[model samples]
Target: MLDPRFLTIPITHRGLHAPGVPENSLAAARAAIEAGYGIECDIQPGPDGEPLVFHDYQLHRLTGAQGFIAATDAATLAGLRLLGTDEPVPTLRQFLDLIAGRVPLLIEIKDQDGACGPNVGTLPARVAEALAGYDGPVAVMSFNPHMIAAFREAAPHVPVGLTTCAFGEDDWARVPPARRDELAAIADYDAVGASFISHDKDDLDNPRVDALRAAGAGILSWTIRSLAEEQAARRIAQNVTFEGYRAAY
Candidate 1:
């Protein structure tokens, strides 16, 4: 049932790892390349409206900085070190250059809970611009269906997908009840024109995912942290967007 075009190869979530290379750092990307695995990274809008390769909404966890990632300009971000390491945050352009067509790159565009703030409205376009001349296999995805649609229009040649999970109690405060239900049910698949569905590993049993795969849509699962998890993912989803340990194919 897996879509061979994508899951045929292995993928590393936030790239390969080491003691020094933090997640989403350029060093992590290089580590993934050296290890011969497909690369995956998170993208967010920078203060200057450019797309930067970062994972969190805030910089405190990774950079020791005390502000939102959208609050700083790309130049300022380039100057700050990640996790106290000498390695600085790299832009999407820099990330693509490093990959250089050697392996496929999957980009997850981070969303701000459907709230348009700062440069958030223009993120899909900026990311498309960054991927313009890159000669490689690249794809974009987001939890926000609207953003996914935007990317489809902006870069029809590049495959776009929807990354989703079944919402539960913990998400109620942040997400509206009706909206949560819609996402949990994947109610926007056809409307968004998603080329793939990156469902949460725990929610892969959803019948909708199975339906999509039956229809020839790619199904990729995320954050697989162990061999056991990888094995489980293979039985259902096409690929594993993994981390915490190297994925052994």
Candidate 2:
């Protein structure tokens, strides 16, 4: 059976945030904990191979720094503040320590193209090591199917999933339409032993999503920004990985 814990909780994307608490910041994680919501965070590898709680490949978008996040060492990332906030970018171990299994965590292992950027084949093993004994209700997912397969081998007990979207014009320009179709279809679900799927909110019409849901696998929708959208998503999905606005569900 699917874990009732995941199905029952409303997941806050990049932690719960408002005003000064930046997304994926420890402060945001604390806020989510305080509000009693499941937390979602994205992980990328630092130059030292430590998994960092972050969302973007480039640091400039959140930190105003002029380099790739994967190029920065853990020590350098730990020292920098996020968008002038007091919160520094934290390692996965640090973030896990703060949570201390108090709330469920949905960790999104980020990737570029088909691999985990510069980390390549090492990220899954690193993340598995960090999460080795964590007692929290945690799951890992990635937009890259190969990453999911890699992580599955690294942590067989941890629930792994695929995060996919139906391609828009911009997304199609980047990845060929044929590739997008394959992704949306979740071609690797069986291969990776995926327990859930976090799909794009705009792309809920996907047949693979329907097939998974029909087969009783968990289905979560991403980046729901409003109560209406959350409600709309809940009609098809079991839960939402939400952000921007507080989720009422």
Candidate 3:
């Protein structure tokens, strides 16, 4: 089972982020911490396998830079600014130190393979290493089950989860239809040793989600942006990972 705080606390999606505060940036993380909310952020591995607090594999959207994060070195990543702000990408090391066990943290390790096949690389191990001795209600999950499995092997004590979704083509264009069907079914939840799921909020009606809940899996949902949305999500999910607007209990 996951730490109960993850179920009860209102988690800020990519940390209470708004227009000026880019998602996954330290600014957003601090805002969430100051607001007394749990924080959820995504991490991508830099060249040295150190995890950077970021969502996109490509640097363009957040940093206005060229190339995928995998291709960039730590020195260069440390220099690139986020969303035209003064904040450079923060390492998992920097992030953990800043948080210092103040609030719960949920980390989503970005899938290394676009198709979610294998190719998980060292990101999971690196993330677990970064979280070593970190005292808090912290958990890690990934869209890629292989990544979760890897982290499970490396840090069995840390709570592990799956980032579930309906896997629609509009959003998951790179994943094949067969793979999409499998992911939507959450076929790997048990195999990866997942204790919880952050599912697509709109798809909570899927009976499999209910089945998992009935079987004692912790139910959570993502990207809720309004009070009405939060209320509806909480009807199915015990807690929410949200952004854009404030989430009310």
- The digit string of per-residue lDDT tens for model 3 on 1-249 reads 599999988999888888888888788889999998999989988887778898887999889999989789877887899899888888888889888888899999999888888889989999989989999899999999989999899999999999998999999999999999999999999988899999999899988899999999999999898888989988889999888777774
RMSD to true structure for each model, in Å: 2.5, 2.1, 1.2
- lDDT per residue, candidate 1, 1-249, as tens digits? 222435666788888856788888889888888888888899977898688889898899989988989998666677899887898888899899888988778899987545311223888888988888778778888887878777778887788888888877585456677877887788888886777888899998999999988998898998788999989987889888888876776
TM-score of 2: 0.93
- Please give the distance, in angstroms, between residue 187's alpha carbon in candidate 2 and its true position after superposition: 1.5
Model 2 residue pairs with clashes: none
Instruction: Give the per-residue lDDT of model 2 (tens digit) for 153-202.
Output: 88888998888787554755665567666776788788878888889999
Best by lDDT: 3
All candidates' lDDT scores?
Answer: 0.81, 0.84, 0.90
Q: Model 1, stretches more than 4 Å misplaced?
A: 1-5, 113-120
Clashes counted in candidate 2 amount to 0
TM-score of each: 0.93, 0.93, 0.96
Best by TM-score: 3
In Å, residue 176's CA in model 1 sits off its true spot by 1.4
